[model samples]
Target: MKTLSFDGQRPCILQTASSVGKKEGEGNLTPFYDNIFQDAYLGEKSWEKAESKLLKTNLKTLLEKANESPENIDIVFGGDLLNQCISSNYGLLDFHIPFLGLYGACSTFVEGMILAAMAVHGNYAQKAIALTSSHFCSSERQFRFPLEYGGQRTPTSQWTVTGSGAALIAKGGEIEITHATIGRIIDYGISDINNMGAAMAPAAIETIRRHFQDRNLPNDYFDLVVTGDLGSVGKQITQQQLKNYGLDLEDRYIDCGDKIFDKEKQDAHAGGSGCGCCASVFSGWLYYLLRTGKCRRILLTATGALMSPTSSFQGESIPGIAHCISIERKTDNQ
Candidate 1:
């Protein structure tokens, strides 16, 4: 249970931008996104290439928003669901900034942000960009069925989100990165690829619990506690798990997956799941909330299932991990 409590000057969130596809743009937080393309391809030849464009456009948009250029970014931390994180690798190829690619499945955004914040806060860099992206077509081909297959999806299956988000972290700003909790991998023997919610709920619960314990804070310490891609099913499981632990999070808990689509009309059985799910939502809605004083503090626990097609085919259970970071509105209260 390793948790880091950041002290002194925390790295600041200077800017953030989210670029989502048509469906997500039509979702609950549509107004918060920086850009939305009606075409999933985004004028790219293939799905993977489209995803790469998503990242590129997102980072470019973030820089534009911050009134900076690629040269101002000391380094970039990014990842995607694609093998070897090729999407991030090639997406950022044109940039002159040093890149450190990472992979944490759906949790890649927070993983990158944590590392980027560390680099900036430790004085190793004056500024850094944290980015992650995912696409429906690309993720489907790699993780599950092909688009042409039209495979009948199980009711528990979640739709892969198509989007990307990038955030600029600098040495000073109004939004501070406060603390982080690095999760442990835990597998409860769930092998159903469609039921990722069930597979990942326990990991979210564990990480959230450990975070609270490590920080010696109660559930209400933060105005909001957000989870990545846990959808409705995983949300229920996590809520129940917290209840079992004598902690109730009903008031301030929100799952990014649950907010990405309308369950009644969208037919997104379990809701959304992908690296972009949390990335876009956080960059858009959550970032706005924090910046505008609607939320004073938030605990963002992005969860990821460390499983692959090979592992699933080999009858291996899906192991889950959750990474948490606290974001707060900077003030002179201290």
Candidate 2:
């Protein structure tokens, strides 16, 4: 039986690339992304197509950065917020690599990374690409009202990001994926569609706490700790929960959603929330920070709300999950 946390050989992170839309391009991590499309559609006919293009562009950039061809990738793990993860499925169709489609809502990127790392650690693959994406229009159309509806949004509502992030996992690299803590589903019976942050908070707290206990490590073990798409609400709640457990993250916690937009000026009510939320940040800004030696060891706990449009309409409460992965610099890996 698989335990809550597992230990294995570290897998290398050979290359990474982030490609984002115009809005994210203007955000704080603008300087970190490899490519930023001036047009959100990227010359595609529809918002969905735009999202597919974002993933395709992200993969192209990753391959270029690694100086490798499509055949070089042993396997591809990817996902998105779409109904069937059509964005990732269709985006890489031409590549013809063995693909494993996944869905963890906002946690898709980290989930993919965890699986990719596992494959490498087990010697199943020499190279794998872990990637994910999200688009505001695409997600909104599928999960909420139409984009043209102009419906008033609640303050708890979060803006879905429009972008993609990809990373090449291979043997012998400067960055190593060291550990993973798979989360169990937790539902606090939250039914509101707008308050995903609050709904996902408990799961994030549980996963972080479990990770600490499983590793027998203190809060200071990692130089940085981040969560996926939790925004302000989840971050605060998770922090309070951690305080109760005597695990104070203090200055180490970074909620990827909270850093994605200017809440006040940008009208992003609860900041960014989507699969791309952490993906773009990690592959772009956070990874850059790690490479620059600004931090040594980092724990990324990617949170996801497992409620679908059908589930929400059926009056089912949102169930949340969080998967954590430890990434470290070459020196720290030693």
Candidate 3:
């Protein structure tokens, strides 16, 4: 079975923090974020350094909110969109905590959480932290073109979010990590670099279906089913495709990409993308809903397009992957 259930001493999210750049700060979820930087550079010399700073700021805020110091965290799982995962490496260097870096493209946030939860559940760590970040400037340059080029964007293109999110996990909390489903890579022969939503939708659907089947859950079991950075195009595709499998999401489904920005007002073409898109939204808005008991159960499936510039240039198709985790609000009966 691809899905694993945390039946004993379930890991829980004790606290969370989100920090975003200037453009993201102006979006619809402004009030939910912990910190909003007025400058994209964050007073740093380069965009990469700024992204590292953003991640560090979020981790600091998470620790402060949990009233725990760096020494209390047993391990940290983190990553970013940059090459070599430098954002997480440098950002967490000063904290002197044990770190394990990961790379799952836009799905890094949920990937980190799954590993962190597993660590705590297996008694490998008493306290673990999951962190991820991405910057529009940095990702744009690496994945597409440099910002100075002023390239024309297609309507299907998505704006990479500039933000970071961190969560502190412990043995007990208000929100429990109940189950997790790791996804498999799925490709539909999509090659357009700009249309990542189309490339990743199939993978999200596969993971969602497997999760429901493995757990013997009904289609409407979860209060909400959210995807990581599918943007508007992928969200639509997922909704349409899932119906063929006898699952109807209807209004109960939403995409983090869609929720991160105001589609009508914001200039974001299709919507938000990148690792931080879902990271910030989950840590900020979704966390608020779960913490406040507004949402009882949620299935968070983070999607990612596993393609590189070199691979794209070689005419290779983009393969997509998604990882799902089920979170539930603690109740008196349980």
Top candidate on lDDT is 3
Query: Model 1 reaches what TM-score against the true structure?
Result: 0.98
Q: What lDDT tens digits, residue by residue, belong to model 1 across residues 1-334?
A: 4688668988989999999999998888889999999999999999989999998989889989999988878999999999999899889999878998898999889998899888988999999999999999999899887788957888888998998988899877999999888888888989999999899999899999998988788768889899999889999899888988977887799899998998888878899999999999999999999999999899999989899999999989989989999999988225
Off by over 4 Å in 2: 1-9
Please list the C-alpha lDDT of all candidates, in the order they appear.
Answer: 0.90, 0.88, 0.92
lDDT per residue, candidate 2, 1-334, as tens digits? Answer: 1223323556878889998888988887789999889887789999889999899889999999899999878999999999889999889998888999999999889999989998888889999989999999899889998988968998888899887989889768888887788888999999998999999999999888888887798779999889989888888999889989999989888899999886666878887899998999999988888889998888988899999999999999999999999888878655
| Regions of candidate 1 where Cα sits further than 4 Å from its true position | none
Task: Judge candidate 3 at residue 219 and give its lDDT.
Answer: 84
TM-score computed on alpha carbons, candidate 2? 0.97
* lDDT (C-alpha) at residue 299 in model 3: 95
TM-score against native, each model: 0.98, 0.97, 0.98
Which window of ten consecutive residues has the lowest lDDT sum in model 2? 1-10
Ranking by TM-score: 3, 1, 2
Alpha-carbon RMSD, each predicted model: 1.0, 1.5, 1.0
Stretches off by above 4 angstroms in model 3 are: none
